[model samples]
Target chain A: MKIAIDLNGGDRAPEEILKGCLEFLKNHPREKLILCTTKNEPDNLFDLNHPQITVEYFTHAVGMKETPAKSKKEKPDNTIEGTLRLVKNRKADCAFSCGNSGAIILNSVDVLGLKDPNTHPSLISFIPLYNRPPLAVFDVGALGNYVFNAELYFAVLHETVDIYTKLYGVKEPEIKLLNIGTESWKGTAEHKNIYRMMSDSLYNFTGNIEGDELLFTDASVIVTDGLTGNIVLKLLESFNVLLQNFRNFKDCKFDNNYLNFLIEDFNYETIGGAPLTGVNGKVVIGHGKSSSKAVRSALELCVKYAEI
Target chain B: MKIAIDLNGGDRAPEEILKGCLEFLKNHPREKLILCTTKNEPDNLFDLNHPQITVEYFTHAVGMKETPAKSKKEKPDNTIEGTLRLVKNRKADCAFSCGNSGAIILNSVDVLGLKDPNTHPSLISFIPLYNRPPLAVFDVGALGNYVFNAELYFAVLHETVDIYTKLYGVKEPEIKLLNIGTESWKGTAEHKNIYRMMSDSLYNFTGNIEGDELLFTDASVIVTDGLTGNIVLKLLESFNVLLQNFRNFKDCKFDNNYLNFLIEDFNYETIGGAPLTGVNGKVVIGHGKSSSKAVRSALELCVKYAEI
Candidate 1:
């Protein structure tokens, strides 16, 4: 499979990005890579002589602070646009970025387009739950409002779960709507409408699940509007940071090993990036401060997802 | 002050409930209590002959599973209704219950009525933050949808904060809307409208705050619709539960002391019951599974809040 990667993305940018690419190439010697970079003289660490790697230099790179839509419209030759064009032209199976997620989503949709115009692209990530298969949380930040139809949202979630089940050899996933209460009467009119739609649809719907259940429940797919999902995701992230700080405090009497183990579940670097699911083309976006390990894992995910 | 107590409330009703009241009475010998109970023969633990305590008998008790509105209407002599009536009649300065929160809220609203007919009562709880004053979270589960007016909600929150500032001797509290993003453009139209209203209003309105900031930000009050607030509150509760489980595991290497300290912050029992704010009467509702200690703390809170 041919995978395109943006070298100008992320906080560590070209250095970490090149190291990740090299790591992926080392593991999958048979696979090909289309590396997009804006630098005239690439970093010395990057092995330009790799036979399976191709370089496509761009004239500009999207800044982290620039508005995504505006930048995409004005800077036509930026890395995000350039890398997506490769996927658009069928030159690569998929594209991956450790850049500003907003830019990635805006450019991908504007360039590669959506699978269906009526459907919005959602950021899908796995939240590892102890003793159960990882729960899939979708639309973490892709769409801010409940703009899509409930039925369409369910269809996208079901399809994503189906893909996971097939790839990971897990059982058929049980879908649950994340709400304040497990009761049918809970949440807004939109939530109730979604619950009714899911209950009536062909998907294996297992009623409503509350936020507290996210850590312990057996539901494989937890669906929510992007706003709630983003808030929950970020809340969890910030909580993990607090735990880490507590573990590192000099006066803390806790055993560092156990604290590390407790925090392992919250580490995004371990699982790498989340995919922009439901888009017409494959795209993965990672954390801005991703380590080399996270970048490598993101590339591995790209390959694994591309095969499906 | 004559404080009303529900004798038949909570998971361990009458027993733990009475124990908590006794604990409170033992500490505050000057305070008066009017206790409501459906049981003809109260538990032996309750000091029925205490000079400061008076018992009120009722024929029926509200069960935990019954619908709040229906139960309040049908069971007029229930513990919640009886206790609230004492407050409505000015027979008690405040009321405390470790009962079904739904029943407490519904009964309080229907019986005592809100300070204003157009106003909705919100469940307000203090979330203790590290090295800072506790943050007040409103509408935790009181109003499920965004049915309350933005301006009225702000006015109520501002008044509550002002009262707290005067009583607690803290600085004027800053209020922020709990939202998906810090950006003014984020969240639903209702949220944006609230933002605008708050900005124009004569209150110390901070911009929108994300869930991740709940634990760390300096904002004294975080406001949101009940659905989102409930989810966020429960999510934090569950996260703390997970930490406790990890601490309890025999094989875990963490120091029990530090783990215990971390867990203490998440303990709802320590702070006792949350107030059903905006109601004309003072009502505090504790967890159903509250222990004697939680009950004691809740009574103490009732005394403190009543003084305001």
Candidate 2:
């Protein structure tokens, strides 16, 4: 299996990304990799002589703050586009990028077209639970600005169910809708309409789940509009910071090991990246400020998706 | 100042509600209370001979799960309406209820009436911070299903700023918009429009604040759509439950004091209730499953608002 790496992506591009690629190669010697970087990158950053590694260069790299639409219209040969192109042409089984999430979604949609235009791209994040398996949250930010509709939400839910089933090896996982209340008649008109649609669907559809029950719910997947999903995802991801503030509030010096244990699954480095599902090609998007270890973990995730 | 309380409003109606009033009266000997309850309540539960407490009888009580519209249309003289009517007719300075939040908002809007028909009623919740003063979060559930509009958002924000200033004694508190990102161009078009309107307004408006920064942000007030605000409020309030799950995951015995200290401010009993602002009268809405202690706290909160 082959995976494409955007070496010019992320805040610490070209250097940390190169180290991550080297780290991945040390672990997986037989797996092939296609590296995409900007031509402006120094030669010292591209010293990998492994036969399994192939290098591709682009003229420009997308900035972290660049608008996705402007980047798509202005920078046609950007490194992100170059990285996704390998997957489009079937040269690489999947692609990974730590660049701007918006740019990645836009480029992935352009280079690797969506399976159904009505079904927008969604990022599936696994919410860690106590004893049970992690809950899958769909559409974290892919369709943030898009209006919520039954058809669009249903398509994304279907794709999420398929991907979640493949990942967990579950025949028909239970799915729940993230809402303000658990009552079926709760939420806006749009949400009420979606509720009815999902209730009649073939999936193992459960009732609505509230924010307070998010971590405790037994539902395998929680479907929500991109706006709410993105907010909820960020809030949960910031758990460590919240705990630290609490620790500081007491002015106590706690052991780092205890804090680490508490935040074991909450660490972004461990999570690596989230897949941009509903697109034709396998694509993994990492955080904007990902470290070398995080990038390496993201590369491993790309390989995982490719192999699956 | 006299506070009107709906004794038949909460899940633990007359008994716990009456106990709360007795508790409040015990603490504040000089304060007067107007207790609203249904005639169906047993005489044994209403035998309190406190001269400071005045009882008002109603024919029916609103159920916790009943729709606000149906309750308002079908039951005109419910306990909740009777309690709000006391505030409307200046018989009481403020009102408190631990019933359905939607029903409270709807009855409050009808009985108390909005200062501006264009502006809907909003709940202002004080989110406790570690070392700093509590942050004011606007529109927690009052306008949950309402569509996003710049004018409506600005109106709610104005009312929040006014009430927050009165409560905290701040001449001009800083305000921020809750969004997925801090960027000016982030979020949906409606958010962008609201952001621009907030920036141009005369209020001490800061830039957009993300969910990750909700607890740590220095901004004194964060204004958001009701749906997002309610979700964030519930998630933060459930911090104690999340920590309990974490402790259980580790399977270790931790001191309850440490857990209590960590969740000291998150305890709903201590917080009491949130005020429904922008209406002609002061209204405090408590949780549906409020205990006697929580009911007492809500009564105290109503007194606080009344005195302010």
Candidate 3:
């Protein structure tokens, strides 16, 4: 199996990306990697002589501030577009990017194509819970403000969860609609309609769930629009960072280990990156500031998803 | 100043509510309390004979599960309605309820009326930040699923912030639109339009702010539709509860005091209740499961708002 990596994607690109590629190579010796970089010559940190890895050079790199649609159209040789091409042409099994989430998503949809052209892909992230299986939150920010049909989004989410359940060996994954309240009458008309649709379907529809339910509930999959999902994802991310800063308090009486453990649940690095599911090909997008370990985890996630 | 307290509201009604009334009476000797209850006789927990307090009995109580609008229409004697009636009839300066937030909002709007009937009320909650001033998040549950005008919402938020700044002696409270992203191009067309409108207005508009920015940003008042605000508020509340459960880990090495301090920041009980702003009369709504301390804080909040 082969996986394509975008070296020009993340904030700490080239060096961290190269190191992560090495880590992936060390862990999965037989799995082939196609690394795409904007640099003509690879970074000195990476031993390109590794037999399992091949490097592809791209002339252009998309900046974080660049509009995804415009960048995709204007820069054909951009690392994100180039990486997606590899997956599209069957040169690689899957693609990974830690760059601009928006750019990666747009370029992936444009190059790799969507499973259903009528529907947009959703960004799905796995959040680890204390005692239960990790919950998957979708549309973390792929569609943005674009009005989407609730039924289509749910259909894509259902199909994505089916693949995830089979791949992870999760038995009877419960699907839930994310809303402000769990009551039947609560939420927008669209949300209520979607809830009813899911309930009538064959999926293990567990009814409506709230944002707080994400951490403690037994539901395996939660669905929402990109706007709400993005806010929820980022809020949790920021809260985690705030908690980590608490460790800096030298005079505090809290146990360091317990504090670390508490913050650990929210650490996104442990989960690596989010997958752009409902697309035709396997695509994973990491945080812009992902560490080398996180990049490696993103690559590993692609491999796991590729197996499905 | 006279503040009305609902006795038959909240999960722990009558007892907790009565205790809170007594606490308020003890703390604010100059403030008179008008206690509304469904019971003919007080719970005996309260010193009803106190010169600062008076009890008014009602025949009906609204359950948390009952529909808010339907309940307001059917049960005119409910504690929420009865409490609001005191303010409407000029018997009480303000009112507090730890019952159903929806019920409080609807009954308050129905009984006391809005400052402007065209402008819907927003549920404004004060979230205590670590180093910075507390952040006020609005539309926590009010105006649910309604297609509200952005201009009206912003107007109400701006007016509310102006009052808050003057009342709390806040110097130049910055107002921001709560969104999925900080970029100008982010969020729905309505959000972007609101951003532009606020920018042109006299209010200190800081453009669109992501959910993560809530914790560390200098923006004093964040505005969003009820659905998003409710989800965000509940998400934080649930996270706090989850963190509290972590205290059960006796073997962990974290400092208990520091851990407690971190958890305390997200504690809803500390803030008492959310004020239903944009209404003609002052109405503060507390969490349904509020303890006596929280209930007391809610009553104190009503007094403070009444002073404004």
Candidate 4:
């Protein structure tokens, strides 16, 4: 199975992305690594004598600050759209990028197309709690206000969780709906109704899980709207600073690096990127500002899902 | 200034509530504590005979499970209603109850009236986190969804924080508008607009504080709907159990129960009894299943704010 990597994506672009492609080839030995990029200049990595790291070139690139639709329309020669095109044509099994998140999402939806009519896919993040593996949280910001298909919003999560369990080998990962309170009686009218609905025996449901129980507890999957989920995940990216403030308050001390490591573990990309599940095509999204390490993780995730 | 103690409210009504009341009265010395329940047929000294704990019979009692409106209509002689009548007649400066939360709200509105015309006072809970002093979260579920008054919403929390500072002797505690994330760009349309109104630089705005950071951190006042605030507080109640499970998963041993004192330091009542702040008159509403402890807390809360 072949997986395509975006060599000219994200802030660091070709260098970090290319470094990951080479590393993956060396580690796996048999897999073909397709590096899709725009030939802004031919002198850089064209001379690297690597047989496994195959290059497919376009002539333009998109800057991160540029609007997604603008970049898509203006930069037809951009590598992001070019790489995705390869996958749409069945030239690869999956596509990977540590690029502009907005651009990636826009392209993934507009180019790859939705998996089905009923399914509204979201950008899911796996956060690892203290004892449990990673728990999936979704629609981090796909839609705001948590309305329109609230039931189907949950139904898609049901399908996503079913896939996550089988893929992750979780014996019985408890699924908890993230809300304002643990009581079914708490939250807005919609949240209250959802809590009561989950109370039924249909799914192995735990009552509403609070946000504070997120990474420090045993809840496997905490579900919520994209607005809350996205912000929580983004704030998590800067948690190193937050940990020190916490340590001072507790009047205790721990390794600073350990704090970041533990916090990073909660953001499931520490394990690997998640397949944009329920999509028509195999699409994987990694951190837009991903390092070589993050790229490697996403590739491994792509490989694992491809085999599955 | 006198505060009527129900001596019967909360989870541990009368006993714990009574002890807390006596402790406060003893410390304050000058404050009058009116015990406003029917004298028992056979009672112990713990149930009677304090200099300030004067017995004033209400001729009736209320239970946790009784329907609020029905009980109020059927039992006009109830201690709760009697206490309200006392407040209205200026016979008592304020009334307190630990039992029948909804009953307290309904009766308080009917008897004393709202603090102002537009008032919809909310409950505020002071939760302690290591990173910061106990944060105050409001509206534990007093107001229903649809049409939240922005200025009144701020006033509810502004009054709550004012009380926190007065009681705790802290200056300028950081107030945060609880949101889905702490990012520069995040939150719902309503939350976003409210956040903008709050961010006018007139207040010590800390921007958005995500739900997850509400625990294990220091935040002085966290504002949200009663539904959301209670949800997080409830999880905090169950967090120790989850922590024990987390320890087991890591195969680590620690003194969990030994730290129960620190764990339970966040007394829900210190900032007890959600006052429908905007009402025309003073009204303190306690939890329906409030035991003695809750009753005492509500009494102390009202007694402190009796004049205001």
Candidate 5:
């Protein structure tokens, strides 16, 4: 399967993203990749001799300050758009990006379209917490005006569990709904309804989990609407940063390198390429803050998800 | 002001709870307390001697395994209910328990009668997170049903801030609505409407806060429904415990001395409590598996909140 790579959109844009895409190609020879960039000469950056990789230059990018809608509408010739167009034209199996997540999602929907009425792109984040492996938290801030229908939630959770299990090699991933309580019936009307559906569904369904439970519960997949999922996911991220700060203060450190040793090596690409589940076309969105590591991980995860 | 104390609640129960009550009396002579238990009696098992602390034995104890509903209904004559009745009858300003939280809420609703419609007994938990001062998280398993009403949320946040500022001695507590993202128009219909109300209202309202911003942002009160609050709070508790476990591994022993160092010396309430907020009267709830220190902290926080 071939993946179209967006060479512009993230903080570092073409430079770091191109380097990471090249590195991913070095590791996975069986995989084919197309690098679409705004760089004056994409071929000048790499050897350009490798058959597994190809390059195209689009000459424009969406800046971080612009609103997502404005960027997508204004920057038609942007590398991120060109990359998604490849996926739309079926020249690439799925598109890989390290661009603005909002812009990526906007373009993803504009080009490939949402998989279904409810299939907006979501940020799927995982935290390596406690004895449990990574807990997948979906919607790291995709849906704004959100009311989850139980069926779409089911699909997202299913995809989250599937992709997470494949990545961690965990047996029987425990899928827990992101909730306000431990009982089966808790949370808003949508969450409560999902709880009811999950109760009789095939998913592991650990019932309603609290805000604090996100860090400790053993569930591999914590499913919620993009609205709540983003808050909790971001909360876990802040908790992690706070814990590191506390440890640094406790030990009197100038830097948190020692504490960082205990945490999982975060790869931007892995969480960056959020699979727009239920879409007819294969597509994924990456963060605008993506570094080289994130680009590489997104490529791998998107490739794996596309295979399914 | 006087408070009724459940001297029989933790592992040490009457022993430590009574001892702490005595210490409070010694330092705060103006503040009086009523200590009750199945038995605060000591036949070489415990010591109890405080001139100002009144001890009364109800002669029946509710074990942790017993459901709060069943225990309150069956053991209506028990110390838990009888001690709370002191508040109902205005014999004491409020009641404090280091026992089961469920029991306290059930008994409080029955005895003191909660603060009318739209507000039931909700647990207001303090989360010392981010760079900001500690914020209040409510409804940590206080109820199962959740309505996406912003006004009710404001009421909880408003009252909690009122109590928190008075207790912590802050000038004005800032409040923020917890959501998946930090957008002017993010969140569901109810939250969007509530956000509008909060911004319009007199309270120092910060616009939408994302989960990632939770740590670095400067907001004292983060409001959510009970179930989500419970998950986040419990998950944080477990992480704190896990960090302790890691520290224990590093220490190579259960450093009781160091544990107490964090408890007594540092003034950090090593034990946590869930106070039923918005109730007609003050009642503190402790973990069912509360140790001696936990019981002490719960009692102290209860007294502090009552005074505020």
Candidate 6:
């Protein structure tokens, strides 16, 4: 299997991404990689001399601060778009990037197109819970610029259920709407309308799940709008940072192994990357601050999708 | 100061509420209390013979499962309404309850009335951080039923700024909009529009704050719509529960005092209660599952508001 990796994506991009590529290739020597970078990137920065690695240069790269629409119009031949194009042309089985989430979603849609044009690209993340099977959170960051509509939500819901059942082997996973309260009338009028739609559908639509129950929920799939999902996913990730500050505040050392057990799933380094479902081709996204290990895990994750 | 306490609110009511009142009176001998309960409540359930304590009976009480609109129409004379009436009539200096938040907002507006008719009641909670002074999170639950409008949001912004300055003595606090991303074009068009309004206004609008920076932000005030605020507040509160589960999973005990310092502000037991601001009279709301100690702390919080 072959995977295309975007080198001009995150903060420590080209350097850390190259290291991750080398690490991934070392473990899986048979796999091939297409490394995407900017045309201006100096060749001496890293030795891309391996037979397993191929370099694909792009004309422009999206900045972290650029809006998706502005970047797409101005920087048409960006690195993320070029990387996903490899998957589109079947040059690579899948693709991985650690770029701005909005830009990634737009580029993925433009390059690979959507399986269902009515639905936006939904980012599904597997959340590890204590003493329970991992829970799936949908649309972590794919719909930042989109508006809310019943048809769009229904499409995303079906996409989430289909992908989750296929990956986790749950025939009919309980689907829960992420809301402020468990009661049917907890959120705004729009939320109630969505709740009714989910209930009327053939899926196993459980009522509502509040943020407090996020870590302890028995439901297999939790669906939310892209904005809410993005905030929630980041909030869970921030726990790793909070725990570190807490340990420092207490001026005490915890056994590193035990601490890892408590927060391993919450960290990108351990949990790896999330998949952007609903797209025609397989795509995995890493955290923008992803370390070398995290980037490698993202590639490994892309490989898993390829196998699936 | 005479404070009205809702005895028909919360999971452990009557018995727990009585216990909290007793605890409050023991420490504050000069304070007066008016206990509100349902007419069906047994007289022998608790002793209310003290000179400082007076019992007031109501015809109905709002249940946890009932929607605010249904309850308001069906049960017009609920215990929460009766408790706030005491404040409205100048019979009590302030009021506190662990009742349904929606009902509380409706009853507070109907009874005590809003300070600004255009703005919805905003629930402001003070969050304790690790090293910095406490941060304020606005509209934690009050806007659950309201729709988005610029005039309403502007009113809420001013109300939050006024209250935060009065409470914290910050002349011009840095105001932040809670959003999915820090970029100007991060959220939906509606969010970008609000961001523009805040930036153009005289308040120190400090761009957008993401969920991950929630705990680490240096901004004094974080403002958001009710639905987002409710989810964020509950997510922060859930950390206390998460920490307990982690300790159990690890089978190791840390010093309880240090643990208290880390999560105290996040819990109603330590933070006491959050005030529903933008109302003419003081209204404090407690957690539904608040322990007797939390109830007492909430009443103490009401006293602080009364003095102000």
Give the CAPRI rating of model 5. Answer: acceptable
> Cα deviation of B56 in candidate 4 (Å)?
5.5
Docking class of 6: medium
TM-score of each: 0.89, 0.92, 0.93, 0.71, 0.80, 0.93
Q: Model 2 — TM-score against the truth?
A: 0.92
Over 4 Å off in model 2, which ranges? A14-26, A50-52, A244-261, B245-261
Residue A135 error, candidate 1, Å: 1.5
Q: Please provide TM-scores computed only on chain A for all of the candidate models, following their numbering.
A: 0.87, 0.90, 0.90, 0.83, 0.79, 0.90
lDDT tens digits, residue span A1-308, model 5? 89988776677877888777877887898999988876664456766678898887785777754567777667778877888888888899988776666677777778887666764455577665534456677655565556667766665666666666776788677777776546554566777777788778855765766565565566777777666666555555554554443343343332334334344342233355566555556767676567777788778777776686
Candidate 3 or 5, higher TM-score? 3
Q: In order, what fnat does every candidate score?
A: 0.45, 0.32, 0.50, 0.18, 0.71, 0.49
Q: Taking the tens digit of each residue's C-alpha lDDT, what string does model 1 give over A207-244? A: 88877778778777788866778778778877777677
Report the C-alpha lDDT of model 4 over A1-308, residue by residue, as the tens digit: 68887777777777877776776677888777778877674576768867676778887776765666778888777677766787889888888776665677678777788777677767667655544556677656543233424665666766667667766777567778776544455456666666666676446677766655675556566766565566556555544333333334343333344443453453434644656655667777776567677777778778776676
Alpha carbon deviation, residue B237, candidate 1 (Å): 1.3
Tens digits of per-residue lDDT for model 6, B1-308:
89998888888887887888898899999999998888788768645578889988889988866777779999988899988999999999988988887889888988888887787677887776655556888767654454556456667778777767876677789988878878777676767888888988855888999888887788998877666677777777777776655454344455555565654445657656788877889889888877888888888778877887
lDDT by residue (tens digit), candidate 3, B221-293: 8887677787788788777876775556555435555456666666777778888877888888888788888
Model 2, C-alpha of A2: deviation from truth (Å)? 2.0
RMSD of each: 3.4, 3.1, 2.6, 6.2, 5.1, 2.5
lDDT of 4 by residue, B1-308 (tens): 78776765556665666667766776677788777776652377455567776867766788765666778878888788877788788878877776676677777778878666556656666554443445666656543232345566765556777767875667787777776545434455656766777787437777877654555345577766455455455545444333233233322223443333333333454345645454444557665444445555666667666755
True-structure RMSD for candidate 5: 5.1
Worst 10 residues of 3 chain A by lDDT: A249-258
Supply candidate 3's per-residue lDDT for B116: 82
Worst 10 residues of 5 chain A by lDDT: A261-270
Q: Whole-model lDDT for model 6 versus the true structure? A: 0.78
